[model samples]
Target: MWSLWGLLLCEALLPIVVISVQVLSKVGDTVLLVAECPPGFQVREAIWRSLWPSEELLATLFRGSLETLYHSRFLGRVQLHSNLSLELGPLKTGDSGNFSVLMVDTGGQTWTQTLNLKVYGAVPKPMVQVFTAATEEAQPPNTCQIFLSCWAPNMSDITYSWRREGTINVDVELHSLFSNGQVLSVSLGLGDKDVAYTCIASNPVSWDMATVIPWESCHHESASGKASYKDVLLVVIPISLFLILAGLFGAWHHGPCSGTNYLSVPDDF
Candidate 1:
């Protein structure tokens, strides 16, 4: 009779030990699961496993899957195995979320565990680039309308302004400001002949500037009939005199009449 009682006690304790072991072994995201087993029989086949959420939500928001999010194969559909650990890469504001793991055992058991990953970091500084016409080429004349442009990578929304170093009137019209910090076109009407112009571009985070010197009008007066006659006389007279003097000097230096010896005159004719 005592042996029968001992056997009953052992049987009750065995189920409790098995349940405790199974619960302790479960370490990852807990999944709620249902186990189908024989009635009145202790079942050890049913176990809790970790669940990995489908990357659909992450893909919808960030346009990438979990593998791309973590930058490693650490957070997707991990089987229940020993030493199960997840390594997430550099986290961003988009990475913060409540993630769950769903598990299903062979005995029709299902369970889930939720994990809230909090990610924090700074956003990278925007790449800035200033653009304008090459300096080697002749720019448009200042008298006519001229355009100056500035650009930045990944930025479209920008503001543009024109400034001069010296006193000069500048007529400007802002054409377009993009959403990503870029200046499309800026027109300037400059009347002054010798004026320096500067185009400045600014955004919420940074700013850039470009300087340009437009082609100027020639200051020389136009040639007229009277002016042409005067110019010809002024140049031709000096050149003609110089050539005459040079010819005379050469003849005197090398001619028979040259030197101190005089021509012999006949004593008797």
Candidate 2:
């Protein structure tokens, strides 16, 4: 049977044995791994190691000193703090994996902790492009088929989602060609001119969005380089009124309305 004092001591030490920590970081960013020491425990030396994707020794730190020696792939990108914590910066995808740290206390007791790091690239600004599908001719009268594609240039590991008017989800009846929401197929009628959609591109680290109106895009494409009758009227009406006013001004200045007397008084009078 275990005594009460022994059980209490075991309970206090249980939390520090083989601890695991998780860290999240983005590409070109920095992350810190803390070496948590138990209360009243004095560390004499600390050794940090990378344990996954081919094991390698990282760095070592000594107590009471701010200097540390880094090795292998962590030469210029790593720093060890005075309290046995590690700081790594300007991170890359290759830096993701399991890391471990071992600390030997002044009494020769060892403590170990494991850290799991995950790195992700920031999601770029997405662009939504609209196209009028060739199947419009086969569709019902006064209806159009529009195809929309969303993309983030030079980015990967991203998922796409769509919303209408920036709030509501896309209708269930609409067809989505890709499971990742990269392409959307929309069928619109004449009454759906006000419909608009936004595409959101996201990754674990960041997200971006772009918006497009399928009807407006398709209409603009069909009307390219051709002026509407209403637009022509707006331009012609203004110019016609200006021309009429200019003609009246010219007649008043140069016609019989001029102040010059046509007949001269007789010299004899």
lDDT of 1 by residue, 147-197 (tens): 334443443445656565466353443244454333434333445456555
Pairs with backbone N, CA or C atoms under 3 Å apart (clashes), candidate 2:
none
Candidate 1 error regions (>4 Å): 1-143, 168-191, 216-269
Q: What TM-score, over all chains together, does every model reach?
A: 0.23, 0.66
Candidate that scores best on TM-score: 2
lDDT comparing candidate 2 with the true structure = 0.75
Q: Residues 78-133, candidate 2, lDDT per residue (tens digit)? A: 88877778888889878889998877666756678899998888888898889887
What's the distance in Å from true for residue 115, model 1? 24
Each prediction's whole-model lDDT (CA): 0.38, 0.75
Which consecutive 10 residues in model 1 have the weakest lDDT in total? 58-67
lDDT score, residue 153, model 2? 94
